[model samples]
Target: MPEKQRLTPTVYVSVDIEADGPIPGPYSMVSLGAVTAGWHDADGFRRADGKQGFYRELRPISEQWDPQALAVSGLDRTALLRDGTDPAAAMRAFTDWVERLRTGPDGRRYRPVMVGYPAPYDWLFLSWYLVRFTGGSPFGHSGCLDVKTLYAARAGVPLASVGKRSMARGLLPDLPHTHHALDDAREQAVLFANVWEWDGVSRSG
Candidate 1:
C-alpha cells in the first residue's frame, strides 16, 4: 500500500474580503486581501511549514462595485478607478504568487491550504473572484481551513464569540484592529500557531 500522508499542518494562505452583505454573489466583493505564511528550508524553498509568502490587494470590479461595502472598507472608488489594476490581472498575479510559494523561486510543486478565521465568509469572495476572473481555483476544494472554528474548539468557546475582536482578546491578547484583511489574517495565523504549539493538538482535526 502507498504510505499514508501525515497531516503536516503548514503552508497556509489566509484570505479576507469586505463584501456588501452576509453573503457574496450579486452583493459584490468590495475589497480583498490575503497573506501566506509557513516554514522554509535552507534553500528558501517553502518547506511544509515555511513562514514565507505574500500579502496583496485586488481592485474591485468596476461594474459590480458596491457602495455600501465601500462605506465599510473605506476604499476609494475614484482612486481605484484611476489607479487600480484590473481584477483579472490581480487574480492572475495572486495565483502566480501562490504557485511560487508552493514550488520554489525556480518553480516546483507543493501543497498549501488556504486558511481564514471564518473560512466561508472570506472564501465566498475569493472563490467567486477566482471563478469569475482567474480561470480556475488554484487552491482547489481541499484548500480552505477555518481558524475560527479551530480556536473555538480548542479553547472550548462558542463560535458566536469567535470574531476578530473576540479571538484577539481571548487567544492573541495583543492583536488590535479589524476589517483590514492582511492584519486580520496575520492575527488568525498567530492565534492558530499558539493553539497548535502550546496546546499541542490539531484544533481542527
Candidate 2:
C-alpha cells in the first residue's frame, strides 16, 4: 500500500459491551452498543453526524453467571432470556451497520476502526461474537484503537498510571459514564475523539 493510502482517513467505531461473567462461552454478552466516533483526517477529529447507532441485548447462552458482574449492568437476565435478539442475527446486523459507515459523503472509503476506552475486554467479547456468529469481523482482527493506551502514550505516562480522572479536563468529555451500553458507547466515542486530538497539553482551564 502507498503511504497516503496507508494513512487514509478513518471512521472510528466506538464499541461497548456488558456481559454476565468474565468470559464468553461460559458466560454471555448481555448487551452490546456501537457508534461512529467521527472522521479523522488531516484537519482533525469531527464527531459523526446523523449516523445511526447499534444496540442489542442478547439471551444468555450458558447457565453460569456472576452476581457482581450481573449487578453492574443491571440488565435482567430473565428478560434477555425471554425477548433478546438472537446472537447470530444480531452479529450479522452489527457487521452490516459497521459496513454502512465505511463510505464517506465525498465517496471516500474510510477504514472502520473500533475504538474503546480499554480495548481488550470489549474486543474479547466483540471479536469472539463476530467470529463465532458472523464468521468474520468488519473491523478486522486487530483494528481496535484503545483510548486508554492512546492517552498513556501521548501523556508520557505509564499505562497503568493513566485514568480518566488524571486526564486534562478538556480532553475528557462532560458525559457521564452510566453503565448502560449505548450511553457509554456514545460517551466513549466522544472520549476517543478528545484524547485522539489533544495536543499533549494539559488543559484544565
Candidate 3:
C-alpha cells in the first residue's frame, strides 16, 4: 500500500498597502506592511501569539500622484521623498522576510499565503513592486487570499453585500482602522485569524 502524503501548512500573512495613487507604475506603493496572522494544516488553525511582520516605505518611482489618495493614508509625500528607503532595497528586505517565514524553525517549508482586506488593491501594488524590483513575486500570481471574499463565501452572502459593516459584531476584530500601513496590516491580521477559525456560521445564529 502506498503511504499517505503529508500536507504542508499554509502560513497566512496579512498585507496592507498605502499608495500615492489608485494604481501602480504610474503612481507608487508608498508604504506596505505584512503580518503573519497564523498557520493551518490538518490540525486546523493556530493564530500567531504576537505580530510577526514587515514594513517598508519606498521612494516614489514616478512624480505623478493623486492628492486624494495621499490624503487617505495621511502620509506626507514630501516627507517620503526625503526619508523613504530606495525601492530596490525595500523590495529586497521584503523578499528576505517572506522567505524566512516560509521556512519554519523546524526546517520544514510552509506555503506563504498573502491575505488582505479587499486584496486586489494591495496585491496589485505589492506584486508590481516585487516583480519590478525583485525580478519575481514571492506570493506569485495566485497566492492571494481576500478576506472579503472569504467572509462572503462563509456567510453565504453576495460579494457586494459583504463589507465589514455588514459582518456580525462578534465576527469583527476590535482593532481600529488606522490608515497607517503597519497598523492596518496588524488589524487585518486579527480579522483574518478570526475569519479563518470561524465555523462558517454566525455566533448569534
Candidate 4:
C-alpha cells in the first residue's frame, strides 16, 4: 500500500491594519492587530477556544498621508506621533507573537498563515514593515490568505460580487465592523473560521 501524505498543521492568524495611506513607505500602517483564529491539519479544523491577540499603534514613518485615509480610521495623527509604539519595537513584538504561535507544546512546529478580509491591503503594509524594521517577515513572502477570495471561490462567484451583503447569512460573523484594529481583527478571526468550515452551494446559482 502507498503511504498517505501527512498534512502539515497550519495556524491561521486573522490580521487587520489601519493605515494613513493606500501603500507602505510613503504611507504608514498606523495601527495593526492579529488574532489566532484557528488551526487545521489532517484531522480537521478548530476555531480558537479564546481570544489570543496582538495589537500595536505605530508612529508614522513618513509625514506624507492622505487626509481621507486618516479620517477613515478616526485616529489622531498627533496623538500617535507622541504615544504610538516605535515601528521597530512594534514589528519585533509582532514577530515574537507569531513565533510563539509557531512553536507547539508537543515540539512540532506549525506554519503560521496570515488571514485578512481583503488581504492585499493589510499584507502590503505588514510585509513592508516587518521586512523594513525586523529584517524579515514571519509569514514570509507568501504565507497569506484572503478571506474574501476564499469565500468567492467556495461560493463559485466573481470576486467582485462577494461582499458581506452578497454572502450567505450563515457564513457571516456576528461581530461588528469597527475600524479599531483589534476589534476588526477579532471580527475577521470569526469570519475566517466560518469560511474555513463552509460547505455550501454557490449563492450565485
Please give each candidate's TM-score: 0.73, 0.93, 0.94, 0.93
The number of clashing residue pairs in each candidate reads 7, 0, 0, 0
lDDT of 4 by residue, 3-97 (tens): 32567788998999999999999999999999899887665787994378899999999989998998888899999999999999999999999
Residue 68 Cα positional deviation in candidate 1, in Å, after optimal superposition = 4.0
Give a tens-digit lDDT track for model 2, residues 63-153.
8999799888998988989999999999999999999888965577888999998889999999999999989999897999999999998
Candidate 4 CA-lDDT value? 0.88
Q: What shift in Å separates residue 67 of candidate 3 from its native position after superposition?
A: 0.8
Worst 10 residues of 1 by lDDT: 41-50
For model 1, the stretches where C-alpha displacement exceeds 4 angstroms are: 1-10, 20-23, 39-56, 62-66, 104-109, 161-170, 200-205
After superposition, candidate 2 runs with Cα above 4 Å error: 1-6, 42-44, 49-51, 202-205
As a TM-score, model 3 comes out at 0.94
lDDT of 4 at 29: 93
For model 2, the local distance difference test gives 0.86
The candidate with the higher TM-score, 2 or 3, is: 3
lDDT at position 118, candidate 3:
94
lDDT of 3 by residue, 1-205 (tens): 3232566678888899999998999999889888888887665678885368798888899989999998888888898899999999999999899889987544667888899999999999999999999899878878999999998887788999988888866778777898988889989988887877777865625
Off by over 4 Å in 4: 1-5, 105-107, 202-205
Ranking by TM-score: 3, 4, 2, 1
